[model samples]
Target: MSRHIAGDMQRYNVRPNCISPFAWSRMVGAIPTDTPEQQARVEKLKKLGTKQIAPLASDAAADVTAQIFAVHGNEIFLMGQSRPIRGMHTSAGWTLETIAGRVLPAMKQNLYPLESSNIVFS
Candidate 1:
């Protein structure tokens, strides 16, 4: 969405970017901490304040557009764009068995972990 908006608004000199902020706020304070892992995550989140997000949203970011900036505490990350990392081709095409045996293994290393956002990012 940010990319699309940035592209469309480029003619007007509008730069649109997205900010995915992980800060300790009222909404985050309400997260359930029933589990040990959840409690640990909450503890980590407590260190990141809402003020940390202000810098990225300010005029300092005027030069960038069509980008996702993940702001956690004082850290800023330029998130990856949508692009293919790996591909495989077969002249004879593929059957289920061949895909399972060949393609899955070939792509397994590049596949993202099956974990929640907090677990993966934290």
Candidate 2:
């Protein structure tokens, strides 16, 4: 969406960028810490304040567009744009068994863990 907006509005000199900011706000404070992992994640988040995200929204960042920035604490990370990381092709197409036996195992290394944003970024 940011890429589309940035392209469409480029002629008008509008640059669209996205910021994924994490801060210990009321919303975060309400997260259930039922497990040890959750408790640890919450503890880490507590160290980040809303102020850490201000710089990315400032005039200094006007030149940056169609980019996703992850803000944590005093750190600002320019995240990679979405794109295919792996691919598989076959002239025979694929059957359920083939996919399960071939594709799954081949692609397993590239799969991302089922973790929350807090855990992933941290």
Candidate 3:
């Protein structure tokens, strides 16, 4: 079963870390700068889908810093260095309704609920 799942997950390209704090805006390099409301847009998209998502383009980096991890039935752990948040579960991926369905679990347990989780980027 593990081998089978590994095969299924192998096709998904594992992107290295690109997420950074907002202070690193000057480090965008070749990628275009974010709009003034990028944070708010990210927050809005957080409600729509994708918080800890893979970068948009090959050159694109510096998406939102917030991320979801861990698992417990229908819950995703919103692991924050500053604060711990949780999300309601879904088929998979970030969605407000799914995030909104959070069923908070015990503290300091770094994990989230998913059917088959591979590489998680936070």
Best by lDDT: 2
TM-score of each: 0.64, 0.66, 0.15
lDDT of 1 by residue, 1-122 (tens): 35678889988878777788788878888989999999998898888887867766677767778888788877788888877899999999999999999999999999987876676575
**Residue 100 displacement in candidate 2 (angstroms):** 13
The per-candidate count of clashes, in order, stands at: 0, 0, 10
lDDT of each model, Cα atoms only?
Answer: 0.83, 0.83, 0.37
Runs of candidate 3 exceeding 4 Å displacement: 1-68, 82-122
Give me the overall lDDT of model 3. Answer: 0.37
Per-residue lDDT tens digits for candidate 2, residues 69-109, read 88888888888888779999889999999999999999999
Which pairs clash in model 1? none
Best of the two (1, 2) by lDDT = 2
The full ranking of all candidates by TM-score, starting with the best, is: 2, 1, 3
Q: How many backbone clashes does candidate 3 have?
A: 10
